[model samples]
Target: MTTRTSHVDTFARDRLPPPQWQPEFLFELPELQFPDRLNCATELLDRWVAQGQGERLCLQAPGGVRWTYADLQDRANRIAHVLVREMGLVPGNRVLLRAPNNPMMAACWFAVMKAGGIAVATMPLLRAKELGQIIDKAQVSHALCDAALAAELQLAAAQHPVLREIRYFHEETPQGLEAAMARQSPSFDNVHTAADDICLIAFTSGTTGVPKGTMHFHRDVMAVCACWPRHVLKARADDVFIGSPPLAFTFGLGGLLLFPMSIGACSVLLDKASPPMLLEAIPRFGATVLFTAPTSYRAMAAQAGQLRIGAPRGGSLRKCVSAGEALPVATRALWKEHTGIEMIDGIGSTEMLHIFISADEAHARPGATGTVVPGYQACVLDDEGRPVPPGTLGRLAVKGPTGCRYLADERQRQYVQHGWNLTGDAYIVDEDGYFHYQSRTDDLIVSAGYNIAAVEVEDCLLQHPAVAECGVIGVPDEQRGQIVKAFVVLREGHVPSQAMVRELQDFAKRTVAPYKYPRAIEFREQLPRTETGKLQQFKLRSV
Candidate 1:
């Protein structure tokens, strides 16, 4: 907190975690050394437009919707004007953003930053109950929601009046954002905010339990641009990025919007991103890079032979990125077998903002999550908080240009210890510095005193021809204390039967450790997943 804050409404800054709970940040790259007074929105958007890139294509939406850099800036600047002139927004005010991955959603997000307001983006599918929890937690002052998704937010605001104002986007109603933007001028003077001022509060996926608000600064957003995309991604200025991850989540926010914009590239936003929809949209939109979870990659791999993925082919597509869960060895190999383009697997959390441990196709090992991206340092730690030798499974701890900063929560002590961000992921770093993800620390299974990683069993299950998707969890048992159980969704033609379960169990025994086989197998039509496409094992344990 050495630098003076630019926040006029200082609720977010006032509620920041205590000094001792904040993790240490490292800015090794020149790009990370942001000036004391900075605004990320200007760095990502306004700078490019100023550098004579205004006419270049910047954002694309479904149904042939497209916006150049100049167009996006004009829209965002107008919205920023509306925020100040119409909505009565003040710097540092928390504003809720609710919408799918589209051009309008992106404009609203940038508008908040340009206006010096703290943006709290939420998943479009979040129900009234979940939305209310976030509003109360952040004391959100205003919201800009899509007309189609306004029902849930309206219901949430009724119950949680801490949310002061609500405005819909897209619709031409008098109170809608579009109508308000029509009245404001196109040009706006961007707010001067400190690099350390809080600009965004991203909530966790609530995979473990209650979601915590993770606060990130204006410089933290720019810091990621220097690390992952510059070092690991090596994205081209001409690349067109597209994915299914909602803009609310950091994964999608970086890949679909920030990363592309940083290099004057174009990004395509999808309204409907199912496997079939994505398969059709990828080629139709000529998207070069694809970002999604491993499950989605597995589904798309089934149709890879029929579609055209780039690099070796004539298609524009070239790279595929998988995150939000461990990338099974089977899924990685399948995509390469069908498309001739190796999939890039990485691990990141909302707290860290974007991918920290990742590798390009050239440096990526078969099943590893790859080395830590440049400008960041990671180590595997034992239960006593000491670094362990390579190849031993332990907690993954990282210190980098960006780290976790929970909003005034006591649990902040657990996330940051001794200046390191403990990501709660169990990983095994090899001698060559490649990190192999085992499972979530809490997801570790202890069967008969022998600890086993559920991801290993799930990876083995995925190799079977009949299994389409699966989630592995430890269930209580009297004999072994806890046994590994796998819930599998069979392929379309394969019917659920007793014989099929036996075959899959035997397949697991042959793949890895003989004792790691799932003793209990349950057939499911579909596995539960969060909006970001992460498997919700917490729900599985409850079931």
Candidate 2:
């Protein structure tokens, strides 16, 4: 088995999670069955051009920046040649990718995958210290970075001896990626990699602590493309995807890049996407699908009345996907009230690669995230690792074509129990088989005898006009074992006064169970969030 593999640098394969700690994978759908030797880049990029659909736009940006399937494949192929012929990048070498969402960055990702190198993509916003951590952890040898974000990566390369080569893409130098690609042929034969070969080393967001590297196989990449987009999204060839999540994050990698490429659909890349920017671009660029977090959706919903959403001429936003964090019910209602598009909410983790549980526009429920996506099975498990009754709160465990595989981490055992991937989220399987997200298992607030999910209170608070953002946490209390405390960011017109606090407290009391209301509320100018837009509740509690 090892002799037939394509990888010459075996660092990623050597550090994979132990066999006993791995979760079971399910490939029930025929589309999920990939060949023993497959390169996902060929499936996503080359196949479309092979089918004579090369002229179709695959990627688009502002200022008339666009690339057809042929253009992207040519760029990717040339880049792949540059990696093997110029940089001496071995098949399994880890290439660190640091760039904002752009055409060339997408090409670099596909180029690495095509050359059989493990692509270790990182957020461009990461500083030198963070970059060094990933460099040291993944032992990344080569890097393809944007010129704008070169300072930190250069500093990281200087500190980490494992990083032997660093190449800049956007620089207009003789040593830049463009200059190197210009000399190479526009077509190259892709490496024949095993289906189980490590293709991507996606690092976690490290919202809790140090980030862990999650490795994925080539078949796993194609499985995500087949399951979510085919079953839940039902995306069409004419659909154009636009989003705020960075390509470094798996959510963005799937929604903004892979999923779109899988169907020959167009995806718009935004270097920086704010709510106003997305709303304005949707019309100018004719974006039919939007992918962002709950915070961005809440902000855009406030401006929805200012423009006609889903209108072909005025604005085109037919589908909206909400993830990264739990979606607030009030935020969902507000978005629909304004835009008339039911937001598709999903729950996914870095370990799982992309969304495993999601729903479409028609089947979307208000509070429930969704039913188990096709090609997957989910259940709520108690602490003893047994199935819990319906409507019972417990840990959410799922088995699918893609499962958790942390690279050389002890926490791998914690994430995978009973041969199932235990997504640290607390959820309930309803009587109708719908999964309801409550909170993170460790984030549930046990106040007195009542069990309170922090998001439920935060959702109620967001319904009030004054509330812009809020995070609920459990703090020590003398009376109750733990009291629900809220750190809130108010809207521009609302001041942080005792009167406003009382009004919010009373509003929460009226919204859900009285015990679930925040016992104390503190106002802030802003709340701390990870680069991916998930609220940092741990930071809130410390404050």
Candidate 3:
């Protein structure tokens, strides 16, 4: 929670060009003050509760379930009491939350926050091995999981003695979660929390095998909601936010959780959000504004105009935002032709938490990520850390209030260079000051919004005696955006077979997370190498 002023040496001060371009939009921001100490559950929600605004809906789902602002506050209060009185949850404890997107998951998130504890939201599809790494890394003591996901949670809990309690919630059962919900009073009081209190621990993939926990203070939550939503989405009381990003991701947390509630707006939760699910939910929930990746838009556009996925029956849908990967120009054109609305693409990372460079409809460049947001400053720098000229590709560096602080990891230096958050992206700025994403310099394979490491996968593959050498790279994928493809040189006597490929995959599943396993494999006699004997990934990329 300690706020420090950042100095960006990556920017070329002496050769800096004049500010000839500026973003076009009426940014009439209200004066905002982030408190020195904060608790997102108790502080931000309490402020809205005291406003006594009745009949304003806070959340709704595709299934026709709805909760008003008053209803939301009451549910959060009761859940907080359940965590405290029944579960024996105390301050400073870490609670692992594994569930799909639903009203109950949202309620549980706030309850964890209200109890002065840090909530670790995990993607529901994660297996026991992945869950164990996060539980061990974050030192999570208690877990609240959906009954469906409880099997995996139980498997993970069996490995660690510190994980004392694993509770399951099933909304449909008569004696299930509703029983727990019925026991607590709706008018329970909020816990008093300091501003610097840790509220959430988001895990991001490291270069090594395990993921690192990025801790955020309650003030960081409020800071992100106030600054990012103000600059990007600008939610109003009447707007409905609909998105496909999992709530476990910081992107989804900002869009689905913090932004909407900060303004008393409504959010639509989608449990099974594939392209078809998105097509079904957008109109079913009457979503006014949508948030998702460019890949989703591409998949929906493939359905042509038959889905009628945008804006519903009326012109209620005013905006659409895309992140996670570059918005291909062809994909953007397809969505515009199908829906008659431009899909705004932005670039963000787990390091900075949410989008900092974005394009609004008013001043959008179809292929370019627009100018920097108000509270942040960005620059493109060459290898020596000097600013490059317009139209030149270089490492993008940014400085802002919400920059990353790793959880006891040494790789922090690679990301935080000379006080600026050095993003892995290779990018360029045009004469108009618009930013364009190129590729990742560190070769971090991003498949479906998940950061994966090549060396980690190679390490796992090397464990097999048959593999002499292996290299992993991301190949273009239609659904996932990119998937891991492995190039392997087998041992002199060993031949590559379906059995060998399956063996390598199963080996990776045991050593690392399942998602990191290579989806495609190729056999070779020898790997192309440099004079220094380093494997030339570029040559493998060509094949």
lDDT of each: 0.86, 0.86, 0.76
- Which ten contiguous residues of candidate 3 have the minimum total lDDT? 5-14
Q: How far in Å is the alpha carbon of 21 misplaced in model 3?
A: 33
**lDDT of prediction 2:** 0.86
Candidate 3 lDDT, tens digit per residue, 15-68?
A: 111222111112134534555445677555666667777468888886678988
Candidate 2 residue-wise lDDT, 30-96, digit = tens = 9987788988999999999999999999999877898999999999999999999999999999999
Q: Write the per-residue lDDT of candidate 1 for residues 4-79, one digit (tens) a residue.
A: 8889999889988888888888887787778899999999999988999899999888777989999999999999
Worst 10 residues of 1 by lDDT: 203-212
Question: Which number leads on TM-score?
Answer: 3
Error of 3 at 434 (Å): 0.9
**C-alpha lDDT (0 to 100) for residue 282 of candidate 3:** 73
Q: How close to the true structure is residue 62 of candidate 1, measured as C-alpha lDDT?
A: 77
How are the candidates ranked when ordered by lDDT, highest leading?
2, 1, 3
Model 3 stretches astray by more than 4 angstroms: 1-32, 171-178, 302-304, 312-316, 459-469, 477-480, 489-515, 526-536
